[model samples]
Target: MGGGGGDGRSKELERLWAERDELDARIRLLESELETSSAAPASPAGEDAAAAGVGDGGCVGGGGACQARPGLAHADSLPADMIYRYSRHLLLPDFGVEGQRKLSRSSILVVGAGGLGSPVALYLAACGVGVLGIVDGDDVELNNLHRQIIHQEAYIGRSKVKSAADTCRAINSSIKVVEHHHTLKPNNALEVVRKYDIVVDATDNLPTRYMISDCCVLLNKPLISGAALGLEGQLTVYHHNGSPCYRCLFPNPPPVAACQRCSDSGVLGVVPGVIGCLQALEAIKVASDVGEPLSGRMLLFDALSARIRIVKIRGSSPACTICAENSVFTQEDFQKFDYETFTQSPMSDKTAPSLKLLPESARITCTEYKGLIDKGEPHVLLDVRPAHHFQIVSLSRSLNIPLSDLEEKLPMLETSMKETLDASAASDKQPSLYVVCRRGNDSQSAVQLLREKGFHSAKDIVGGLQSWAHDVDPDFPAY
Candidate 1:
């Protein structure tokens, strides 16, 4: 009787094990199907451009005759061997042979040869982009090696555009590398950008970024822009089919104080690496017409927490000082456009310094602003960082009125001051205006704002507070 019972139990266990194995096989099949479906490519645009019968040879429009025909440039077509070369892309459901041929026939211009540009150029080249035009005036530096991976240590101190072109060629010798060893300024931006199917902004400065955005918008070319600071970065595709240009999102240049540059503030070496990689992904999406590109959406990444946030940007602003519908930029206007004018401090005595100074004031660094309550500073710590940036890192006592917002928020300031004074009647001292921001530039602008508002005692902290922590106060966090 005991032997019979043991046999029944063993049979039941065998049945259960077989059922589990069958379920595992089903799961593996489902996962494989999901991956295959997700990797499928979307449809391509300019279908006629694909079906035009342009082969690996030069386009027929050129003033040259083919071996078999006279007065005709060889149709821009791919060779049979080239087709085999790009077979992996051709095998892709979305890219296929048609998309690979399209990429082989297309051309793109990349502006800047620094952090963002490095990854963009490398990926585009590796993807078999037919022609890549690089424009940059600066030389590679030792500091660039941290993020500018395209330039090797041996290439340091070499012209960035030249080095970048060499690197691109090394990756894919078939692709043409056009080098413009000059800056892309207002004068040359339109002309240079018009020659390519796409324009990429790998620039780090505000003026250059604005120039690239405006030129791409005017030329109706797609622009991919990316920027990084410390552990945070932002990227977006702009000026694609009447979508908002960069200026539409950020109308005028943020005041010098409000701009958070990697040079002044320092950045993690991997920040631009991550951001640039994303920019390259967007560029590839644009090139292949694959997944939806981040057009009109600012994709923000915080490396510290591995967090990504997307902010939808609206279309052109009617009041946008740069690219509004009514805005007209003529050749004459170019002469009057002063790039240096924006950097001038608003509190300069060149005007009326006397009227600029007024009543109560407080001073603090970006780092110290966090400890305002603990320090018991009797003032309001105003964040002068751009509103978008302020949202990323905000403190309890911080009130965000961007430097640009100052003109709009000025009138209410007096009432707020009075309320603060009333609230602190027991203290007898008037409430002071304490200005602070990331690194300290915007806070200086805030101090200037207070002076303009007739607040005399307004003073910006020395080294803006970042300096204070590094030099005067070792215990304070610099970031």
Candidate 2:
């Protein structure tokens, strides 16, 4: 009886497998039907230009001038590859052939090819945007690989735009990827922004974000902005019809010390990935006119709680300083604006006077510090990096007291050194305290603070461990 039951169960399993295969076949058929049904592409404003034999950059009649070929706006003549590629988009009523054609004609400029730009560029390229312009002056770093997914391990030292363009091209060879491998200062912001139909503020810096927003508003182009730091991210569309610019939402930046950067606070790789993809989706909605844009609304995402909420914002802010009728930034301002100096705190600023006040003797070079350690000289090496980083790869001779907690733990630092440190030293001048941080910037600040607290002999290791990795020890981990 048991043998008979086993045979019967096996036959039932076979029937279920056969049913699954049938459903899979039906899915393929439906996908093909959607593709063929939407084979008819609408004639966009650019179609007339292609028919008129306009040069790639010549007049495209009503759709402005063509940047590449007027290969967009395919009316009833969608390329065979495109039909297969955009099958899913074609199936959706919101983004059928008409929407795809619009996307094909649209050009978007993505600023800051970093964390947020990674997923945004990927999705937009794969979805078939005709032209993608990436602007970034920074180079890819070992630390950036965690969230900046577009750049790979091999691209550690390459310009971010070059790496980003390479990745986007590999994803979709049909689109044109332009690399602006220079900083977008006020001098060049207008020249670059005026060419694109839309701007994506993938930048994290306040100066660049404000610059991009102001430029888009001046050019009457829509802006899709997104930001992710730590586990939280925010997204919104700005400068659309009756929509408020970024200045309307944030007139001033948060205090620099209070502002949290991913380098300091840390970020889950997936957090920015999620926000970037959403930015792409909203940009697509604006470009293709498929759904209501995020203009006049902001989406807040909390990765910890896995929650997303959309809050309404005023379409126009009467008190908005920049976008208001009588505020600031006329079209000419884009040309003469001193964005670099205006937004950046000069090195001569009061807050950064540590290097000025601290004598040259208070800072030791990485090579000098290495010699001290080699001679078994008694000294306290205080690492002012985050505790998690110390756990990853740290010097055995160093003690971790993150810069933020250093002041409160000063007593611990002093007592620990007095009791146990420099035990084998020949002479006792009370071992000098030496500070180090990721890049030497924070280490200088810590040393300055220690000097003020009467640790006159305390000094910072110049260029921190980064210099050590470069000059003294190649095996020292950088990131």
Best by lDDT: 2
TM-score of each: 0.58, 0.78
lDDT of 1 by residue, 153-203 (tens): 888878999899999878775566789999876666666776677777887
Global lDDT of each candidate: 0.67, 0.77
Candidate 2 lDDT, 1-479, residue by residue in tens: 78999999999999999998666545534543444345444355444323332212211222221222224544355554567777898889878978987787678889888899999999988897777889988889888898999999999888999999999878876566789999787788888887777889987666677788888888888999998988999999999868899888778765666655675577899999999999999989998888899989999999999999999988777887678888776867777766545555321121232344457888898899889988878878999988887887877768999999989999988886786555745545677788988767888888888888888888988877778899998988876
C-alpha positional error of residue 291 in candidate 1 after TM-score superposition, expressed in Å: 2.6
**Which model scores highest in TM-score?**
2
Which pairs in model 2 have colliding backbones? none
What C-alpha lDDT, on a 0 to 100 scale, does residue 169 get in candidate 1?
A: 79
